[model samples]
Each structure stands twice: as structure tokens, then as C-alpha cells.
Target: MRTLVFLGLLAGFGFGQGPQATLPNLVPQVVSPPDFPPELAELEGLHDAGRYREVYEKALARKDAWGYVLASYAATNYARYQASDKERQDWFRRAADAAREAVKLAPGQKGTPSLNASVEAKAYFALGQALGRYVQYAGLFTQALLVNQIRSAFSKAIELAPDFPDPKIGMALWHAEGVARNICLIFGCRRDQVQVFLNAAEAQRSNSKRVILGYVDGGYANLLINDLKEAERGLTTALSLTPKTAEDYYEQERAKGLMEELKRRKGGSR
Candidate 1:
């Protein structure tokens, strides 16, 4: 899952302070889902190589649901790392559109085959991720609207695959962001709800959860809520995890960045 790009904006709000990080600031790698498609290995290879633009182009070339899904993923990455300020939102919009196309093509329910369910859930997740990034550039009213849609997409993804942790982490981020901004009362986000979703996600770590940045995301969310102890715990867990891929190493770097923030916050109060 992609990290929050809007977080840098929170620096002025007494959260997410420190060095600015972009969405694709972390190294890229491929994580194949169960029932991996044999034909898509080349595109996956491109993504794993961090050739995001080529991945997007070749993925959309296939013109299938899975193709669109990968296209969305690649486009999101490209937007985060490569696009200029003026072009970033356009790429995110393209990503969201590709994800919508993927959902339209997949069209399945919770009880469907694992591959179908995974594809549909991924499409929803991709859509939510794109919207999440886009919200950073939107006005407050647009942000409210986008946040609701992000919640809806994430909730639907969870309903489809109860074990998938990405959407859960996304929901946790949503609640945390709302709490940090002190807008929970107006938006209906609760502090407790953050832990609820985060715990649910951590429970799946032994099963379906693979990305390490999600742990960084969890810690970052905790930091947003002023839960410094939990923030340290989450970042510590991320640091302790053995890294096997470029994504792992880069995510740990992110965790380390958060750890620095955690340390500064703790030390300054003394």
C-alpha cells in the first residue's frame, strides 16, 4: 500500500513533522497475490524493477480487469514519485479511473473465487488510494466528500475480503487523520475506531499482510492521535521485521524516520 502524501501538510498542525517524503519515496517491489496470473509476470517484473511508467503502459496494454488493476497501481506510483505538482493530481485521477474500470470488469461478490475476490478488492483499494492522495490537493469540502468515498471503498473491500489488511490500515489512517485535525466530531471519526481497525489489521500479519510500510503507516497514525507509546511500539515492530525486498528496506527507512520523530517529540517534552 502507498504511504500518505498529504502527511507533509500536517507538519504545521503539530503532526507529521520533519523531513518531507513523497508517495513513492520508498523503493518499489512486487508482491504477487495468491493465484498469480502467469501472463502478468512481465508487468510485475517491470513494477519490481521500479519501472513504473512502463508498468503502467504495458499493464493497460493488456486491456483486462487485472491489467487495469496493475495500471492503477503503477499510475499511483508514478504520480507519487515522478509527476510534478501540476501533474500529480491528473495521474491520481487516471489511477482512480483505471481502478473503476477494473471493478467494472471484475464484478464479483465476497464468496467468489479467491482470485476474483482479490482482484475486486484490489480495485477498490486502488481507488481508495488514489482518492486518498487526491484529497491532499482538494478544498475542505472536497476533502470531506472524498474522505467519505475513501471510507466507502475501503469498507467495501473489507466486506469482500475480511482478511485483507490494506483497507483496514487505510481506515485506521482515516480515523487517525480525523482525530489529529480535531474534526472527528464533524466527520464522525472516533479515536477508538483507529485502534479497532489497526488491531484487526495486525491480526492478519501472520496470514495475508506482507507490506512492511503498512506498519509504518500504523505507527504514523498512532503519532497523529498523540499516542506516543503506541507509536514507538508500532515503529519498533516495523524496525524489527526482517527485510527481504527493496520495499522492505525502504519501508524500514520510513519506520526509522518516524522513530526519529517519536524521539524528538518525547525528548522535547522533558
Candidate 2:
């Protein structure tokens, strides 16, 4: 997700003409998941192996809400790492479709207390993450068009599960990158929204991945905002966290590179 955010900022899009309406303040409802199912272990195994195609295939075979969410998640990552533009677009499209299916499978409306709301929230997160990546490679007009959808999906996920850190991280990237690019400034984004969401995500970092991502993404956001001190603090914290997976290690290396860049900038500034 941080990778997508950084790349998206580098591939900047054109801004719209005027101040847009503010996003609604949707209240989050507390919800909990049931006991962990055995199928998720298999999904995790496939994901860790980078067999996203197989993960998506197996997840769809489960014919359940969580299965659809897993498919979306896997497909999104697949698209993110794809080497071919056509293949990446196809996978992202599939990811969006699977995520919508997951939302449909999950019971209840937007604000209702349904048993499947948590899965629904996860589905939205996947959709937002995928769309965020898609915009990076899309045309300038397409990027402008999809920006609202990206914001809407992440905002809905946050509204559904405010305590969930991933969506907050996504939101922080949205605000930070948007501000850096001057794309969302007219939409009431002059204030520092990145730290607010990044702090929320950091507060809920319960696992190695979450802890690592919180710092990596927080540091990335700070870098965009030109807060060198905060960016250094965040990347430093990220490197200190123990990496428990390949993805975590990848982020650790990325953070290290960012730290090097920051040091060069600091030295140049002196």
C-alpha cells in the first residue's frame, strides 16, 4: 500500500477545477470477527509463497464472504507486482470485482450491525488499495476520475471499522500524497491529516507486519509532507521492528533506502 502511494505520487495527476465538497463524517461501529478458520491458514501460506494466482483461485472456490475478501486481497497484490501493464490492469479489474462480490456476500447495509461487516470492511480496503495502485498507471484523466473512488472506498472502510489500522494507513497516504501533489488542497485538505491517521494506525500495531507498515507508511507520508525530522523518526522506528515475513523484510529495506535519501537531503541542506 505504501509502495502504491509513493508511486502514485510520482505519477501525479491533474487536479479538478474548484473546491469539492468535504467527505462526510461517518461514525465507526465496533465489530469483532469470529474464531479463526482453518482455511485462512492455507490462504496465508499461498500468499507468503507469492502464489497469488493460486490464492485467488482457491479463495473463490470457498464460496464465502471471507473467501471473496481473500481473493480481492491476493489479486490486488498480484496486480501491484505484475510486470506487464495489461496483466496488471486485468488483475486489478478482477480484484475490484471480487471485492464487490465480497461486499454483496456480507450481510447488512453500510451502518448496520451485521455479522459479516468486518469482512465487508476488509473487502473495501482491498478495493481501495487496488484502485490506489491502478491510478498510478492510469492516464491523467483516468487518475483524476478514480481519485474520488479511492477516497470513498477507504473512507467507507474506516467508517465501518475505525479501529482497523490498514484503512487508516491508506487514508493517511491519500491525504499526505494529495497534499504533496496539491491535488486535494481545494477539497479542504490544507491541514495535516496524515499524522492523525498514521498515529491511529500506530496505536493499533499489534503484529510485526502492522508495526513495520505503520512506521514505513508514516515515514513515507512525512517525507511527502517535507517533515524531515518526523520522516527520520518513522523510518528509524520501522527499521528497529523485527521483520516476521518476506513482505516485512521488503518494507524494511525500502525504509532503509528512504532513510539514506533523507540523510543525503539533510547533508545537502546543511
Give model 2's clash tally: 0
Q: How far off is residue 70 in model 1, in Å?
A: 1.2
State the lDDT of candidate 2 residue by residue for 29-146, as single tens digits. Answer: 1112221134476565556545668879999887777788778877876664432556876787788788888778866523222222377787788788777766765775567667
User: lDDT by residue for model 1 over 1-270, one digit each (tens)?
Assistant: 112344333322211211223334434434555312556766765665457788898898877788888898788767765566788778888888898888898674222323345778878887887777767766654665777788888888888778778788888988888788776655688999989998998887654424576788889999888899889988998888876443455567778888988999999879
| Candidate maximizing lDDT | 1
Stretches off by above 4 angstroms in model 2 are 1-38, 81-87, 108-117, 207-209
* Every candidate's lDDT: 0.72, 0.67
Q: Can you list the residue pairs that collide in candidate 1?
A: none
What lDDT is obtained when candidate 2 is compared to the true structure?
Answer: 0.67
| Top candidate (TM-score) | 1
Q: Which portions of model 1 miss their true places by more than 4 Å?
A: 1-36, 82-87, 108-116, 207-209
